[model samples]
Target: MIAFENAAYSYGGGELLSEISLRLAPGSFHFLTGPSGSGKSTFLKLCYGELMPTAGRLTLFDREVRALSRDDIALTRRRIGVVHQDCQFLDHLPLAANVALPLTVAGRAAPAADLSDLLGWVGLGQLADALPPSLSGGERQRAALARAIIMGPDVILADEPTGNLDWDLSLRLLTLLVELNRMGKTILIATHDLNLIRQAKSQLAARVLRISKRRIQLAGADL
Candidate 1:
């Protein structure tokens, strides 16, 4: 569903990603691992069209990313769900409204029943009426996930999704991603948690990619 050919990205006269090439097949599951400032987030941004490469080509869902217009990218984003390190939510809005924001921004209204069910799925059913500041870190994360998938996106990209959670909470989030993959949603998660990656491997066939030296390589260990 996504491919990068000899892609390179640079900022402030420094190259963070260089000549990187990758292909994510439809319904495939993959994990991206790297140290801080190692370009994992940069690569994910490139994949989702947030950052255009300085050179080479990035193809997301068949069309070249750089060639896509702003509106085209916005439309394409509806088919791609993204969970960021810091869950972006409207501080004043209720959790349910936050989860439903994607649909609203896309000019579609999600049914009230479906919205409630989705919030329930993320264990936020009761917290739907609460504002973003009232929720804990894990709660916000799940809320973000609910928002991302509410549109029934074909692909899910998560960057440090469980960064603030404990081991148990992290596993819970991982389980949700695995379930999404089982349902044929392509998944790419960027995280520094090797143990989480190992846990994911035990339950699913997830390819591990490590970013280093300005390129991406398949991890050699069973990570």
Candidate 2:
């Protein structure tokens, strides 16, 4: 659903990502793996229109990022679900309400049944009334997953989703993502955990992409 054509992004005078051209095909699962400053997060931001390419072209669902207006970009972002590296929540609000924030931002009311089902899908049904600060690392990540998908996004872009969780919990979260992919959602997750990547590879078909020389490379052998 996201495409890049000879796209390059730069900061000051240095290019962060260059000569990038790849299309995230519909219903595909990809894991972006690279060093800390390898522009993994920058790539995710470009996919959802958070940042525009400095040169060449980048498109989301066939619409050029440079051509889309601010409002248009905001609307386009609704089609993508993002699980941030840091799963921050409003400590004052309950988990359910935090998950419902997207709906509220979209000026729509959260449907009770759907919300509950989503929470349960991410294994957070019992924590609906729990505060954010009270959740464990795994619980917060799942809650973030629940929140990310509550709006029914067509594409899921997760950045370092399992960074803080243990192996068992990481697999638990990965299972939910794999299930989502089976249901026809395009999934792209940026992570550095090779162990988690290997585990995900066992569960489903996933392409491992590495950033090298400021470009995206398919590392089939490495994974």
Candidate 3:
């Protein structure tokens, strides 16, 4: 869970986010919507402690983010999975290795069978040995999701996950996310795709939040 109280983040010339107050409770699913350069990504970064608040307080799992040491932040990240827009990976690494990178970095050994099962669940079972550069856009996104959840984190933070995929692929990714939410994982996705949000609403309850005028607000029913 995460909470922000009058939180503001500033860089270069001015503030990207200001006086924002929000909370993500356990097992809640929320969608973040905003125009380009409107702080959706910045907000996601704050959620996982990638950036500290410049004004007020932001707390993750009941602890003030800025107060955490580097090692503490690293450990805290283990409880939060993040999917980025780019789906970054080592080009030369096989899909299996890429998916297992989190466990590797955490100094935990991944059993081969479990790894295969996870890949299969994400629809990448047959492509485990393929290199990241060889994957299609949707495949890369799914692979990224697989890697993000490999640690079995309590919270999942995804930024523009469906930005590059077609409608079908987006739905597939959304279904996977919905399944995770049903299993009680806290989910927050920052995306510009309103159709995807609407599709998610058809399957599960999801609160939509929009960033406008440098503040976060609940979206109207018009969405």
Candidate number achieving the greatest lDDT relative to the actual structure: 3
lDDT of each: 0.92, 0.92, 0.94
Q: How many steric clashes between backbone atoms does each model show?
A: 0, 0, 0
Clashing residue pairs, candidate 2?
none
**What is candidate 3's lDDT per residue for 24-81, written digit by digit as tens?**
9999999999899999999999998889989999999999998899999999999999
List, residue by residue over 88-111, the lDDT tens digit for candidate 1.
899989998899999899888989
| Residue 49 in candidate 3, Cα distance off native in Å | 1.3
Q: Candidate 3, which segments miss by more than 4 Å at Cα?
A: none
| lDDT, candidate 2, at 48 | 92
C-alpha RMSD between model 1 and the true structure: 0.8
Q: Candidate 3 clashing pairs?
A: none
Task: Report residue 51 deviation for candidate 3 (angstroms).
Answer: 0.9
